[model samples]
Target chain A: MFEIRWHSRAGQGAVTGAKGLAEVVSTTGKFVQAFAFYGSAKRGAAMTAYNRVSDKRIINHEKFMSPEYVLIIDPALIHTADFTANAKENTKYIITSHLNKEDLVKSQPKLEGKEVYVVDCMSIAMDTIGRAIPNTPMLGALMKISGMYEIDFFKESMLNVLRKFPQKIIDANMAAIQRAYDEVN
Target chain B: MAEKIDLLETEVWDGNMAASQAMRQAQIDVVAAYPITPSTPVVENYGNFLANGYIDGEFVMVESEHAAMSGCIGASAAGGRVATATSSQGFALMVETLYQASGMRLPIVLNVVNRALAAPLNVNGDHSDMYLGRDSGWIQLNAYNAQDAYDLNLIAFKVAENHKVRLPVMIHQDGFMTSHTAEGVKTLQDEEAYAFVGDFKPMNAMLDFEKPATYGVQTEEDWHFEHKARQHNDLMTKVYPVMEEVFAEFEKKTGRKFDLVTNHRLDDAEVAIVAMGTTVDTAMMVADQLREKGIKAGVMGMRVIRPFPFAKIAEVLSNVKAVCCMDRSSPGGAPGMLYNEISGALYNSAKRPVVTGYVYGLGGRDMTVEYLKGIFADGLENAKAGKPTTPLQQFIGVRGPKLNFL
Candidate 1:
């Protein structure tokens, strides 16, 4: 089973990102469970969502206590939340950060050993979508790191999910995804 | 909520979304809903469907949960296919009209996302509202996951609208635990689902003015006794049999079988846990782990809570040496509702098992695998000692003092 946990503020689309990923993955005939844990329903409150994928049906409905992959959509969560508290030894991180990998590790040495892929997702979203919603860009970073699906697959699937939006919004999100996919390191 | 999913293919849906699809495919005539946590999406998605011209239905935005059920009653009494959704306090608000819906024999299907009733005010998943509506005369069905949520809603419409069981049905899914969690759900083709539920045949419908019927009439001492007896005794007795037939038909159509009670590792087992909602899946996982360690742990998941499956529960649990009854809702000052019911089910059995009551996961607290293993360990010890080691009823993961009661 591949377990993933996502941390983000309420309006940042982490819940939708997790759900979108689950929907796309299930198309490949894998069993998946995606859920979000919410507190207050305000726009800026920190919240977490989770995903579990397996070749077999998943029966456990509890929260993912130990996740293999951690995706942080809100970079501020790195300092504000214990995003890595339950991570395994080989747990990988796909973080939406403005800081480079060296500066990130220099400031937070605890993140040195793990497979940490950092991207300027907020800047990417701003440059591409003209908005700071980093969820799609972060998902691109995740796809790039995990190789769970081809970047085009995520783009097409996400475009389908966002089909209701205006053409510009859709094009911008697609552009953000492509840039994040190419630039995450 | 309105992103298109290919209805022709199997798709991922949360419990709320799955139930919403059932409502949409069933082609419900009216949905009167008040937005509440964990339950809002069920009706919200329906509203989206209504907006997208995906369904032909009336979406009523009522001011409160009470008004929502009242609107459902109005629409249902008018011989329209009607449904609504709510959780916790919202459900509690509608308690007064719950009896009106069932007693009037209106077959309104209610989707109840089970959440804890508030004093501390929790928005997470629990069974407090489920237990609160236990005596409300609605035929209650519990879903452990997304698939069950989808399947049970379709079955509920069929069973509730049946001539023999013209009663309202409350389909319960653990609030956010199931409602907000997305998983792969096998869906029936819209035509197949509509065909399975058949057409709406409303009996004694208010709209049929040719054969006029009076609803909500006062029943004083003269005829109240017989009405109560028929409503509570005779008709309630018919639900299980009707459900059995419906289950059979659903399995034949969708290839998914449902029982009043679902068992896992129960055969030839010495220790078992009895519970409802999401906890059942967690207990089953723990039971499998216990089996790996050479312990005879089993799980009994109660699918239907009302018209309590007494005989089936007794028969399934009769052989176990120890049984733990998991109640996700708080009892406040009494033993958990499941505990009391299970105790009554086994009260006259030939072989008496050491039954213990455990109140856990109240207000959406997580029922971890570790906690479940500890519960099984305690139950096994109780079986070995032929009695409960701790109090007969106790709270599992609550903070502060270990609260126990007789």
Candidate 2:
């Protein structure tokens, strides 16, 4: 099973982002299970959303200890919690922050070199989405680094996921996902 | 053609094992569950089925109790014989759909491993979960040992699917007592059990592509009262008869006959204790000890609690000089949940015995048959005096003092 963990606070649409990713992954005929767990069980608390992708049925219902990919919507969370404790040597990290690759490495020295992909999801979110919610943009970085899905597929799925939201916000979030997908290189 | 096989020579399994076997035997199309104590074993066993390729179904590992019930509702409405398991707070979380499933009359059968609802939050066996849903239109059946858990579950699906009673059913077994308790139970053969469930052809399948219709219609007293009244009348009257008929039919097929209620040694008894679920075991053992002591004590086990079975409860306890009502539920405004109901049922009777209500084991108090002996002694005390109260109630086994607090 390919486990993808998303780190974000509540009310930041991380649950929506995880479910949206589920919708996209499901389009590829792969069985997908996406859900979230939190400690405080309240809004704005640091929470983890998880996804398990597999060819066969998944029986393990606990939190993922070993993840294939990690999408950090808030780079600040890296220091607050043990985000990479369960990560393997071959793990891919797609981080969303204002800093570039060299500065990010300087900030978190342990993350020096390990298939690391960076995206200015904050600036992208403000420019396109007009808000600080960077989950959609970070998800775009996931598509770029993981290459498990196409950018256009996430774009289409995002349209459906954000259909109930404001129309202007929808267009901007779509643009943010695309921008992150481009900048993750 | 010699297709169907006989039921007697099937494999013997334990109650917990029988529950898992029956879910598979029933060909459950979908299972959505979140892990909770006591109820966790069934889901864990079901997960093993998915891993070992025993059952052909999608299992959704949900985040919380709400999502678990929602997923099952979605699957059931789409014409699948869906099932889910829960206990305690998990059962409390499904309260909304517990009402919806019955209001929609979706014939959803849920297995509740009864647990104590907590303030300090205990995860042990109790009846608080099913008690919270007494008014919710689900047929409630309490199971004693693992064997009753196995037996009631088989009949639950049959009753729920009956056109006359297309309502949700809650088959409750005590959390650690019956759910975790290991005991021998007989499961029907695969081919025979399949023939038993037959095809789960829902009358109002919301997913029938060709024949479209609405279900769970929202209303504001136009036809709502009529629909509700019809539901209640059918559930109390029509369903009772159909329930008996189905049991008879099942006995013909599986060679196992079950009664709605079992009055164990009630005849010529001076006092009887009324209880359900695993407490019945304790009551039975206590009955034996009481007989040795020459107390003339007996046990009455409740099979159904939803339709209340008021008439039956009144009839059985009428002869006994006093009845001790053992309950695991606490009603905030009234006496013990079952106590109030039993008292109301026996209120008009000319020989209304002195009834005592006990609301112990709130969040798992480790109830034993000896406890029943104490309660029966209390009932006998009230009875031998030849004086009964207009309304009598007391929590039999509270911490310090027992009083009619409510």
Top model number, TM-score: 1
Candidate 1 docks at the CAPRI level of: medium
Q: What is the lDDT of residue B196 in candidate 2?
A: 74
- Report per-prediction Cα RMSD to one decimal: 2.0, 17.0
Off by over 4 Å in 2: A1-185, B1-15, B252-256, B388-391, B400-406
Task: Compare the candidates by lDDT and give the number of the best one.
Answer: 1
Question: Model 2 in CAPRI terms: which quality?
Answer: incorrect
Worst 10 residues of 1 chain B by lDDT: B1-10
lDDT of 1 by residue, B326-397 (tens): 898878788888888999999899888889999998888888888888888888999999988968888888
Error of 2 at A112 (Å): 65
Per-candidate local distance difference test: 0.89, 0.75
